[model samples]
Target: MQVFEDWNQKVKKTFNATNPEVVLTVSEAGSLLGLTKDQMKLYVDKNKLTKVPIMRSVHRYLLLKSEIDSIVKTR
Candidate 1:
């Protein structure tokens, strides 16, 4: 439980540090949304959420902080 709490605090700190132009990793996005990594991928796959490709690899994507905030507002 302590470990989980510590992880959550780290995630929150990371999220708060992000700026509008910044892009987040899958783990970071999942942390902001309170979802697992797999769940975040699922959301992307389903088109319920969107991400930006960081490179030529489709698997390497980044989420915008604005989009995350919009999702949170809707929820």
Candidate 2:
């Protein structure tokens, strides 16, 4: 019981620390943009879109939801 409580607290703290606000995975961003995952990568590489790094890992990136929304609005 005590261990479970501790783990729960830790999970809550981690979630709070991350405070994920409008972060989308590459696949998600691609879906929103009507592009395939490969095309999404290309877009990112071409600087047509920007990504937020996660855990300082090059392979893990998140797109800003607000940016996606803006693109939608423009279109």
The alpha-carbon deviation from the true structure for residue 41 of candidate 2, after best TM-score superposition, in angstroms, is 1.1
Error of 1 at 6 (Å): 18
> For each candidate, C-alpha RMSD in Å?
6.3, 6.6
Q: For residues 6-34, could you state the per-residue lDDT of candidate 2 as single tens digits?
A: 43234334544677665666777788889
**Per-model C-alpha lDDT, please?**
0.68, 0.68
Any runs in candidate 1 off by more than 4 Å, and if so which? 1-20
Off by over 4 Å in 2: 1-17
The clash number for model 1 is 0
The prediction achieving the highest TM-score against the true structure is 2
Candidate 2 deviates by what RMSD? 6.6
Q: Cα lDDT of model 2 overall?
A: 0.68
TM-score of each: 0.62, 0.65
Which residue pairs does candidate 1 place in steric collision?
none
**Model 1, residue 22: displacement in angstroms?**
2.2
User: Using alpha carbons, what is the TM-score of model 1?
Assistant: 0.62
Over the stretch 1-75, how does candidate 1's per-residue lDDT look in tens digits?
Answer: 344555434444565466446556777788888999899889867866566654346466667767888887888
Quote the lDDT for 19 in model 2. 77
